[model samples]
Target: PVHAARLTYEAMRVGAPARRLAKSLQPLAGRCDARLVYAYADHASALAADSGPRLLQVADEMEQIGALRYATEAAAYAADAFAREGRQDSARQAAARCRALNARGHGAVLPAMSELDNNAVMLTPRESQLVQLASQGLSNADIAERLVLSVRTVESHLYRAMQKLGVSDHHKL
Candidate 1:
């Protein structure tokens, strides 16, 4: 549910009062979505703290923890918030950051569950490149440096490639 959660509050904007949502939001107080909800509310429903800056901070923290999906989500929200707040420069920067992370395969779109479930597995260009480099005995860090990707991203691509290729060993590739 967390993975699929969105940051919109359209229903709230035209419908319920803030107090009405308080009870429902209580359970999510310490969760990541709480910040998303409240930050969104802060922009529209007269809550506290500015969302643009806060969401960017949250995005950075999530990225540091390797929660790329969450980071991308937060940055996208931040960009929207900044744009709404008349902070055009910050909005563009946040949008660019969101795109960069989303390009790392952490966008809102979920992968097709049946993609890897098929008998025939196809390698994406990035996956194929990572696999080839790994087969050449390059460390993940080395590949990351050459490819301008994070080490974790390199490792993730290789892991997915290994699964698709039906190989348990990187050395055997």
Candidate 2:
């Protein structure tokens, strides 16, 4: 059942609608493994959020057939929903649960590093300078002043640098 749910989720990821699947599973919601049902319901809800409104129905079914893992994942999902809705307090509460679950499962807060290609460079000299200053926690304006360039020019260089490094944000650099 878990395998089936995972396959179904993958199908949904590849553009298959989950509403019909969710409806079909309604009869087995209680009889099926609760953990599998929870995962299925999560995928259904995510798909519905983007594809349609049937996810709410799936969520209702999930509530009727609950499990501990589902509750944990639901907290994380709720945090994301609240964050999207601009409800900071509710989001934080939910995010805290996610962090707790992550800690319990992995026993560490940081991602493991890979040693492969650890020392490589693809940035130009000016781009390297932008990233270096950014790593030191300098603001764009400060970096610009230090480099004797206009703030907008610094921003352009940083943008290009991040692009070349395949990162989207300064924090990633």
Candidate 3:
């Protein structure tokens, strides 16, 4: 169920019109972080101009439910929604909420909040490992062998990681 929610949330996050998948989780709305998914789906429509406010409402509600992590993520999503609408003022407020949530918690930046932090680079787990390995002088083939992945896959992950790091060469990984 958690996996399903993640897949649905990711789909919605990437601008996929996967509301049907999100709707399927409506029954679980009051449990296991489903409320956030459902709320995202509700605001995922094209004309949902109130996404920031609505999502922030959900974030506050999640706080009352003791789902601080989800609340922070929802607030981050709210920040993005506001940014997309050119609402810089609202976006900054949402960003502040996200930071507060992070400080109140373990201070670990959640995936959703990474975009709100300019100092953070959003890297996939695989890309992070590839960068770490490449930094240690592991060739693509060596990384492939160590991780049981294809050489092409290793190269691809390294290429993307370097791009995210704004390095022109894998040697900088």
Candidate 4:
């Protein structure tokens, strides 16, 4: 089942049509591992098709079955899809799920998830403050002085924060 799941994901990544991939996954569907993978594949397909509700539903099922990583990723996808569809409430709900999963140490630090308006970059409080100051146009040295930290420390904080935010530039903060 795991092998089948890996093949399914690999096939999808290589641009196979969803119907073809679904047919391939069909035989493995009755197995537990394969079912989890199928749920993930379905969630991905729903997201690609802009089916926000279906995406969320599949994500919820994944989470219920303890597929934490996939569930978290699905929720993030659902959030983005919902936002694009102008379903603000649903988007917020999905974003909240992503945040919750991350907080519980289930989700990866995903840049795409950070793009959601309601989803703040996952940062330490100090990092958050540093990013806020940087966003206000404070120079690193000036921010260091304002925060009473050494310039090197400020730069380190900024670098780590940017890394966590999946951004290459402070301006993106």
Each prediction's whole-model lDDT (CA): 0.59, 0.54, 0.67, 0.70
Worst 10 residues of 3 by lDDT: 41-50
Off by over 4 Å in 3: 1-18, 30-50, 118-173
Each model's TM-score? 0.38, 0.39, 0.50, 0.57
lDDT string for model 1 (77-169, tens) is 676666678666676677667667766854444231112212124467889789879989999999999999999999899898776555678
Query: Residue pairs in steric clash, candidate 4?
Result: none
lDDT of 2: 0.54
By descending TM-score, how would the candidates be arranged? 4, 3, 2, 1
Q: Which stretches of candidate 4 lie over 4 Å from their true place?
A: 10-23, 30-34, 111-114, 118-173
- Candidate 1, residue 167: lDDT: 65
lDDT of 3 by residue, 1-173 (tens): 55666666666556565455445555444456555555544434311444788778877866766768767877787888777777766776777787677667667867777666332345578887788888899889999999999999888887876655556777854
Q: What is the lDDT of candidate 4?
A: 0.70
Q: Tens digits of per-residue lDDT for model 4 on 78-163?
A: 77777777776677677777767766654467654656533433457788889889989999999999989999999999998776
**lDDT score for residue 7 of model 1:** 23
Model 3 compared with the native: what TM-score?
A: 0.50
Question: Total clashing residue pairs per candidate?
Answer: 0, 0, 0, 0
In candidate 1, stretches whose alpha carbon ends up further than 4 angstroms from where it belongs are 1-50, 107-173
Task: Give candidate 3's error at residue 11 in angstroms.
Answer: 8.2
